[model samples]
Target: MTQTVSSTDPPTPSSTRPITRPTVVGAWHDRFEEILTPEALDFLARLDNAAAGRRADLLAARRARAHRIRHGEDLDFLPGTGSIRRDPSWQVAPPAPGLTRRRVEMTGPVTRRMTINALNSGADVWMADFEDATAPAWQTVIDGQLNLLDAIRDRIEFTDDSGREYRVVEASQRPTIVVRPRGWRLCEKHLTIDGRPMSASLVDFGLFFFHNARELIARGAGPYCYLPKLESHLEARLWNDVFVQAQALLGIPQGTIRATVLIETLPAAFEMDEILYELRDHSAGLNAGRWDYLFSRIKTFAQRGPEFVLPERAELTMTIPTMRAYTDLLVATCHRRGAHAIGGMAAFVPSKADPQAAERALTKMRADKDREAADGFDGSWAAHPALVPTCRDAFEAVLQGRPDQRDRQRDRQGDGVAVTATDLIGTPTTTPPWITLTGLRTNVSVSLRYLTAWVSGQGAVAIDSLMEDAATVEISRAQVWQWLHHRVRLAEGLVVTRDLVTELMDHEVELLHAQATDDRDHRHVDEARDVFVETALGEELPAFFTPYAYVRYLVDRPLQPAQRPTAEDLRRSEVVRGHEVRSEP
Candidate 1:
């Protein structure tokens, strides 16, 4: 087997191998020690023996709870969620998963043309979308969003510069059309179809996503979503719970929906598996959001450190290596768990909108397709209708020449697993496709343009300290620590960062084997000890404990509606007012 690389594309080495593995996130170390203290474990042992009889009821209750969850009879409904929050309520158990599992792919303006061309060109599980694809806008945001999706879902066609007309297959043939609404922060500005107001919170975003879910699903589309700008597991859990409630309200089957969370946020990086675990019942897997993730890293670390600001339109290679490493990690992490690691959105190529730029853009788009495929991405997104064919062809070509089936020798360890084939060096490797080279170019553009915004930690996480803001650091630490705990191997009978730690986490993580080790807890411990419930051991902590800031919001506030002008109110003013006053007929 060989590690494949495009002749022109470069490779990025990942430190996920070691060196950057933090012993602990600093804050968590104290808690880990406080709970697992010698005195606590002894107390538990004595209590366990004394309460052995009570264990039966505990086991019975646990089984009953699982049964309720599996049956969907216990769905917890919260209205604020279905409207703006986009969160799903997983209170009711999800039914058996669908046989035809699906993963939706997102495309940006750069690759939209090529991606659409490809969707029409072949059969894909779904062509995911981005409200994040364009510049932020509002005032009928719902209508505008629906229009974009509706247009894409129909028989859309595009023409390339060389007089090549690409008419993609109707969504009927492909059928799955997924549209991800704008996330919480930007959602305050969006309005509903009835021109209603929207809230600015995650719960509100959940409600918005939930309310619209029916419309998207009603038109021969199974409900699906791609989570973006996510901050923590709590955020995902919020979405899961909101979704459950939304379905119940809409009269849909309990678990008829599905989702894929974009692991673009740096803090979301280390906690990839945990986030998915929270949404495992409905998860499709994950994607490494290049532009946003890199942007986020810079915002957290560079802005304040540097005296001068970056250029308006800088070069794109600055973060390619990191992006590559991120994608590699995402793919490895997902595949390790038998899930698909969808590739990043392509940045450029096929500017059918401007004939003059089409040639240059097409070249870049195909290159990105090739690179993404080479990086082990199952598929990538296309922004334009014209780009679809190229993107689709590129994916088909990469997979066509590869193996049809994969072996489950180790039973793929975690959230996902990318199937690999032999490469020139006799090393087993998985890449998206050489076709995605253009994405590198796009990534560079997004990196340079947004680098400043990201470094300032201006996007989502706002708090920062000496190294990174407290929130960003916590999020990052969660992922890193969790991945390490599950994938890394401390020597025989060794403890996690035991060399650096005055503490040890004896959790079993053998189940999350793909995390770092090929077997029992390479990154940290066996899967059996994979998770840590703060509440389960809450009393054990040095005693002062807050569940998590985000968790606090989930428990206390239900998603709610925000302020917005009525149709009559807007019509009598501004754009409409001017047109009316002019009396143009």
Candidate 2:
């Protein structure tokens, strides 16, 4: 049902006229009240009012495009936007303060301790992620905003249960804060303007910009962001419009806001030049959001055939042809436009309990960073603060006193690097190696572990010496679906049928139940099992698991009655606006 705000609603009273209050539809906690102040809600409403319709249109367009692809449509760079791509005279706005030296950036959830730790982690930039790294619970959303606010003011601090203290370090020692808001597909149901839910993207960006944009400017930094899950240049255009309007509304300069987009989706990969062109005025650069990109590839090409069926997630390294093409194109495109081409995440988490494992993990991380640096990427992401120095040293080896290699154009004539649409597609000609039992078990374990924490409002968790986030969960579940659909054979020559998958899922659930140490853990494990089964084994693939799991498990709401709607109820329902009414004799 679609709910529209009525035009006849009462206007803001004179006392609250300057900053109109919004109707918050969900429960309000103590700290939530601080973040959702009258002015902040009003600001969010303004953003929603301006961009909500266009967001809806673009989301509909996304569905249409996907539908066309399913009907055998091919994807290539848009000829419509060719002029924007071919224009050689244009460049994005220069890197904003603190963004110039993003040689090693750290990413994590915006929890209090994480905010402090990431800022003090000695990386060049800290991406305070509210998207994939966050679960989007109401309290989490509000608290993340509060944490960022406190971090900005240098008042954030925390102490562990073991009595270890944490506090923001001296301003000079801290990493520059770059906030990543939720994507366009999510809506903040807790807050509604005019009966319709506001975009979560707008809400996160709105609250943060309202509270901190001016302060950041005063601190010699501007409101910087990492845009995620964009699938087209239209989406980038929407964000650029939002930035321009936001700066105008907040009295900041037009170009004060800078954004680095995550070219994560398959479609966005084709529109690299256009994506940068759309946001050129506010563009910082682009990052190779590797995991999600792979997930997107599987999702987009799932039904195409065996050629698109990916190998085990562990086996598909960045050096693979498809990945190399994408990264090469990204670096080439960014350098051509004078933008930084940041690399993918090194998600290895060192273990304190095992020296050998820690050494191996560090070695792997160093190698990954070395490849990214050698490939002409300006910087890369580290999932843990401990990996920062390894990333820094790797980049430092090639950078040699340079902040970035934006001047190193990879696509110049005689550069010996050539990337084309065909290269980007890079469909495998041979079948992938058989799925190993260990690989299958790893998928089940990691997905279950990650989903358990996710349902409990922890979006980022360290599992088996690796940091797992939503992207990891996506990859795991998508692999399960692809394997099942393809009836993939294991090394033992046993096929992955429904029965086998169900048996393994049940075994994993039992293992988790056995390991549960508390009621909370037990409940979360149960929910995780359900989430995994439904998302991985449903008749049709779900576009995303988070939205369904979010409403079912995360939102703090009362259960609805199970009664069917009556004729009178339907007649009077505001949600039935678009339906035709008829009287029966």
Candidate 2 lDDT, 442-476, residue by residue in tens? 88888998999999899999887788889988988
TM-score of each: 0.46, 0.91
Candidate 1 lDDT over residue span 1-585, tens digit each? 111112122222211211111111112222244332344333222322222222222223323433443343222222222222122222212222321322224343113353454355433544433334322222123233333443444634567799887665544565354445444323232222122222223322343344445665566555666777665554566566655655655578766677778876655664565566667766767876665565444333221222211211123232344455456666665554555667665444343357766676677767877776655666666434455667766666767644211111122223343222111001211421121223222222222222222222122211110111122222323322322233322223332342222122221122223344343224222211211223112212111011121112111123211332232322221121011221111
Tell me the RMSD of model 1 versus the true structure: 23.6
Give model 2's clash tally. 1
TM-score of decoy 2: 0.91
Model 2 error, position 489 (Å): 2.4
Looking at candidate 1, what is the lDDT of residue 494?
33
- Which residue pairs in model 2 clash with each other? 5-194
